[model samples]
Target chain A: MKKTVNQKAWFMVLPVLLLVAFSAVIPLMTVVNYSVQDTFGNNEFFWVGLEWFEEIIQSERMHDALIRQILFSSIILIIEIPLGIFIALHMPKKNSLWTSLCLVLIALPLLIPWNVVGTIWQIFSRIDIGLLGYSLDAIGVDYNYTQNAVDAWITIIIMDVWHWTSLVVLLCYAGLQSIPDAYYQAAKIDQASRWNTFRYIELPKMKGVLLIAILLRFMDSFMIYTEPFVVTGGGPGNATTFLSIDLVKMAIGQFDLGPAAAFSLIYFLVILLISWVFYTAMIHTDEENQS
Target chain B: MRISRSNWIMILYILFLMLPIYWLVNMSLKSNQEILDGFSLWPQAITFDNYMTIFTDSSWYMGYVNSIIYVVINTIISLTVALPAAYAFSRYRFMGDKHLFFWLLSNRMAPPAVFALPFFQLYSSVGLFDTHIAVALAHTLFNVPLAVWILEGFMRGVPKEIDETAYIDGYGFFRFFGKIFVPLIASGIGVTAFFCFMFSWVELLLSRTLTAVDAKSIAATMTRTVSASGVDWGVLAAAGVLTIIPGALVIYFVRNHIAKGFALGRV
Candidate 1:
């Protein structure tokens, strides 16, 4: 039987479509306009065909930044996905106060602005004035985010982990909680070991969430800016510059709009493609669960 | 239902989680001298100077005010748009409905960096550049998707029978929604608002790109120092610690609703 469809619901969607179109779609179209054109500094754009895209794709600078972005995002996904799940598995589900406390603590890093996270760690990791820096120095270990490329990479990765791991943990924990106690009871009666229960029951239940966490983390880490920017200024001499950093330097610092716009589109497509892959993976997992 | 060795693991986990926060609070209390002097678990002498900077410095506190204003505005606007959109997606199937839903989700996937240059140009053309609205509107790109995604979860959870019965009782669509659906999803709306607030609050790239002066965020303000002389590590730490308060206040109230909200939608 067909149900009576309310046509009025269309009104509800109008505001969102208009608002989003005005803000997102229009500006994006403008980017597309800039992407295919050459600007001559008088607010006049002449159609330049594929010259900018060709320049960007052939440039070593773009290639290097793309490699760095992929590497950073990949490392972030690997560490964050597993660490987040482990954390979610360990977090308390019972005690109300303890749950609240854990929630508050995990959320602390997320609340701080990205630049501040970089700043906090920058100060916290300084050899002379920073705590981590001085502590490492005192312990006979050398540490300098600004001087050593490896240290800079480690600091940036750790800073990101500290900042975003909670989001994954929160997502996974939420997924964990939604699985009814009946599943755990079944596992208990089957005499499944803790690892087996996690492998067979909890992991399946959490696959969807884990996919989303990975995708979100991958996209954000690939596009990360303020934290690394503040921490190393994309330096110790270009050791940690991600795609977004390079784009900003081109667009804002150097005022290279043509190259920057081209780079930005590539950056967007990479994120879109990666996210689509994850989304398809999630759908595949959901189908497997049904089967 | 029995306590086991897993409990021990939980205890260690809690401690690991609490330690960094403890360090942050510890540093906030210390003088710049103590922070620079050495790494200590406790501040040698506690002081309110860091907190004082937030109050006495107009430029610093303005970031707080601007962030709050823009975040609040964006959250409200996003929800207002999303509530209707989510309801439409949940309640009805119309022409292009599936296409619309995917479109909204795709917006959530697009990176903000790609749009930053275009947004700067678009807003400049419209005379909206470098203002609170510019950032708030830019933020709505993602926030609207988030709100709709979560709100769609809440709407789906509501039984269709509820709406049917309300209509039988002579309730019109808007009246039924106002009286029945809105209150039923009150917790959802609150949760969505909290998450939206969280994202908009912590976001730096779009916010930074959209504003430079008169409405610069603390995140952007902190970046400004990098181009200048020796970095102000102490003041920066103070500023960093202060940014956590609003989010803490939000999570304190809405933490319960958010877990379920996230799991149902993006997760």
Candidate 2:
């Protein structure tokens, strides 16, 4: 679709611009202000001039949290993307009763409040009462998220996979839905193997949605705070403390505003840079589809 | 009929998905004693006391009311602003349009943790703290961007000839939008609304930070269930179950469009 040159369109965009600026820009400026300045208890302030950024960059705590966050996000993307595509492949293709049922049930976790999702898992995985925990204990498998760091990591990771794999499946399923049956029929006539058919017919078709699923999952997992916070409270000795959890603790818990502000700016920049890469790639794909 | 390998896989995956939710529902039905006494696949002695407690307690139930209030307000604001912006992006080229669009999206990607303190101060200074509107307005940080992106995708699917045709038909801008263009993209609107409501309803950090009392979200309220006596397992489970209900209902209504919505309307 060709878009006309229209300067008047700014009026149409003004409401969103003002609303977002009020909601986004002002607070961002405050962060930038805090990042550059230091304050005493009575709000007396002095110029810091990147001292907080230097301190944060050198801090072992931030480094450890960054590593944990990247690892967590990588594990999430690894598990969810393939698992989602696999399940979507096996899903009933037709718009039958089963399709609707599957979609509704798959989407169930996504709609649950993030805290409630944590609560549900908390209830479901308690060794004393939770079925999973009790059953694991009964089977002589040592598992306790509240006690062990590895167990906490496993619990958080599995919880994320359970909570988010549905999103990937849904997106892939939609992409699969858009593929014309003629492609499949052609594959059948050519006597292509299932693997060949998937590689040649389905993979390319799902490229757009796959990029979207990856982008969303990556950003969400990178900034994850609520579910892990609720489930583990970033506990078992800071084992599950991702960047957001650490940032919140600094900003709100400890009132270390300067370092927290610097931490935030860096965190925001990292996400922005990565998302820009993904966004650009997606747009390039869209343009390719058009041409 | 014999079940195939794929059917087995689907069954196992769905069961995996349903297990925790089933546990939540099961816990919601059991008495606290039953929940603490032992683990049961299903509640051996079913009880409605937890649900009764939530229904009877103003503090408990008001959380839902507050959550719904902000979520609805946020949805309305997001859509009202996003509709025109999406139309502009889809229909015309303007100065800084691409940069503006990406900037909005970057907000969607911005960590709520980064904005939490600033938002608390910003809203508190404005004397809007603990109000439903505060949470609603605060949520627009991300929701507005998302709404614009989704609606833009949907609007792009509409042919430009329709706009030209409307102008030729003598329908004014607002008139054509309300009468012809809106109805044409009604499903798109529904899908965008669902995404907005879902995101707003599920978010916790910003909502919890912005509203301490009077407008506490159920997610935040659920935290108070941890008393000195330890967690109230039954009532907490019940509240969690209740939170899932509204989302379930919304999903049911938009089940058909959900796939496209999950794709953020690009599909």
Candidate 3:
């Protein structure tokens, strides 16, 4: 697909550019402005000149939030990527009533409002009323997300896995669907075992889609706010407070605009750098496929 | 005939997915007293008072109306801009095209928390605060990029020869795009719209920040259930159940294209 060098394409893209810039650029500039300046009540302002950045960099709370966020994201990627791929593999390969049914049922969790997801799990994990809690208590296992830090962590993680693993399955399923019969036929002719066939035939084909899946999961998990906020309220003494939650606590809860702004910039940079790495890898794989 | 290993695994996984939702629905059907008095796998006595409250109360039902309003506006705006931009990216290699595409994605990477305060201030200053359009416009920051990415992939799959053929047939550019090109890529449009609607519908942070009362989303409304009243479990569960209905309807219509959308569009 050779594309022509047409400068006129600029005209076509102008509308999107304007709309995005109006939405993205203006607010971004405001964040930058707040990051550099200090303000008191009644809108009085003073030149801060990196003081907020320095203070935030030195803050223990910021350090803890960053560590917790990174740990949460890594754990999610570790668990979800393999689980998603496994689920995708086990999914029925042919389109049937059963397959469509599974697809819809599996995707139901994703379409639920984030707050509702949090609320449902909050009720479902409550010791007094939640089935999980009541059952666990009946079995003599202690399970209370509100009271125990480890329990809260486990609940949030499982909730996330339950909420998001379907995305991975769907993406991998799509990747699997794109593989033509020729590849599997060749594998059968060679008398390949399941593991060997998967390794040599399916893995390479899914590389691009898998990368996209991993990146999407990473970014979404990294910025997760609403569900955790609703469920735990970042409680049990800030144990579950990730970066976004911490930023909100700072900006909206306490009105620490300057430090929150600085924190936001740093958070944005970290996501940007990682996403760029994944994006470049995806493009490289695509170009290799073409060549 | 016996079940295969794969069938069992899928059965278990689907059960896992449905358990929490089943729990929500179960709670929604129970009276708040029943919900709190004891733990029961099945409701001891079913009640629809929660649903009745939401339907009969203006504050509760208006939240749904507001959420739908902004989500619809955002979807339309995202698609309108993205269609042409996607065509440009797919059909021609213009200067800075690659850079531009990546820049749009970078906006997607920016955490909503980063923009919440600024969005609040910006919208407030422009007198757009508490309005449906504010949330709709702000959502495009992410949805537009995604819509463009998905639409561009679908458009590229259409052969370049179609444009040439349409031109030789004496069809003008806008006329041809509306009549011929759009119809060819209708599924792409469907997939893109679904993504936009899904993101806008579920998003809470910016929507919560940008609007106060007039356009407050249902997600924000649900948060108020947890205040001094000590969590109205039944009403909250009912609201949660109701929020899922629209999304379920959308997925039913787009079930066939969802997997393909993930593969072809940005995941």
In model 3, the Cα lDDT at residue A30 comes to 85
Q: Per-residue lDDT of A201-238 in model 2, one digit per residue for the tens? A: 99998999999999999999999999999999999999
Stretches > 4 Å off in candidate 1: A1-9, A283-291, B1-21, B37-39, B223-229, B265-267
Candidate 3 fraction of reference contacts recovered: 0.84
Candidate 3: residue pairs that collide: none
Model 3, A7-53: lDDT tens digits are: 99999999999998889999898888889998777888888899988
DockQ of each: 0.56, 0.87, 0.78
lDDT of 1 by residue, A177-229 (tens): 87899999999999999999999999988988888788778767877887898
Q: Rank the candidates by lDDT, best first.
A: 2, 3, 1
Candidate 2 fnat reads: 0.90
CA displacement after TM-score superposition, residue B227 of candidate 3 (Å): 3.4
For candidate 1, write residues B1-267 as lDDT tens digits.
675665566666556545555566677788767776666767778788877876798888888899998999899899889998998888887778766876787788776777777888888899988899889999999899889988987787788889889999999988998899999999889989987898899888888888988888877775543445654445666677778778888888877776776665533
The segments of candidate 2 whose C-alpha lies over 4 angstroms from its true place after superposition are none
